[model samples]
Target: MELDFILSKEEKGPSGKTELIYDLAIIGGGPAGMTAAVYAARKKINTLLISKDLGGQVLWTTEVENYMGYQYIEGRQLMDKFKEQVRHFPIDQEIGEEIEKLDKGEKFFSRNSDGEIS
Candidate 1:
């Protein structure tokens, strides 16, 4: 299943059949997940990030002050910046997809919509 990432123009893929493969597959889009995406891109890895939404717990909070580079920032605003930074890389992302299950595998995850890994 060579599904297209909506925000990206590149048709190149790490997707086919019932599963997709990447040098890295990040399972969230929170501060940590987005940050991992950035690092993976820098390392030139074929990466995928699957998330229900961006920001995770950070988005619900009213303010952010602990993150580096900003003494004070709104949670939503911080997430926006993270999203923007992720756009600059060749990363595959699936948004608004809630994962019901995931399991350990050789590459880490081998998943199906029905929550099976094969």
Candidate 2:
């Protein structure tokens, strides 16, 4: 069955102002992190997914057969499906940077590489 929902444009808050703290902060964009983003965003919880790459190890695989849907599918194809699902929600995705540390506060802070704090 096909499902439909409105996808609202992400609203930009004040510049440099941290908003509400997320219920969860996922630090990888493999299958696990992507899945978590899908679930948390659906539940209307503030969620942030930080990863250097979106697909992670899954992007390197050429073929996957044990995933239970098709007998076989290209690894990139599978990752694409995951990414499509993730785009449906307001999950925050930061790419191309490694997470150095996580600071818990009213609004969580994630420090990226290059010593350029965020």
Candidate 3:
């Protein structure tokens, strides 16, 4: 797993607008969301990860048995691993934020809890 590029926080054009364009936007920081981010990054896709927190339902479990490679691992520990893997990539993150609205047309846009549209 090797990537040849490191992306800036946002892509700016000659006019210097701070708007960011992503090839993919993943909502949630759970196992599924984190997994998607990893895959997207591996493909060199510009990605955005939005979530209120890192762990989801899996955080409530005391032990996980069916998660491959580990016979028995703590919920938090598993989530930590997922987080680590996700951080290894240059995926954009919006943790602790929630999407309020989403619009689709010529381009897709979303408004987060802070009222800032992206």
Who wins the lDDT comparison? 3
In angstroms, give how far residue 78 of model 2 lies from its true place.
Answer: 0.3
Per-candidate RMSD, Å: 6.1, 7.7, 5.9
Which candidate achieves the best TM-score against the true structure? Answer: 3
Candidate 1 residue-wise lDDT, 1-118, digit = tens? 2322233234333454234445566777898999999998998777888888988998998998877899999999999998999999988888876666655533344355666654
Q: How close is candidate 2 to the true structure, as a TM-score?
A: 0.74
Candidate 2 per-residue C-alpha lDDT over 1-118 given as tens digits, one digit per residue, 9 for 90 to 100: 0011223224334575433445566789999999988998998877778789999898999999979788999989999999999999998766776877766654345667775545
Q: What is the TM-score of each candidate against the true structure?
A: 0.71, 0.74, 0.77
The lDDT ranking, best first, is 3, 2, 1
Error of 2 at 91 (Å): 1.0
Candidate ranking under TM-score, highest first, comes to 3, 2, 1
lDDT-superior candidate, 1 or 3: 3
Error of 3 at 4 (Å): 24
Better of 1 and 3 by TM-score: 3
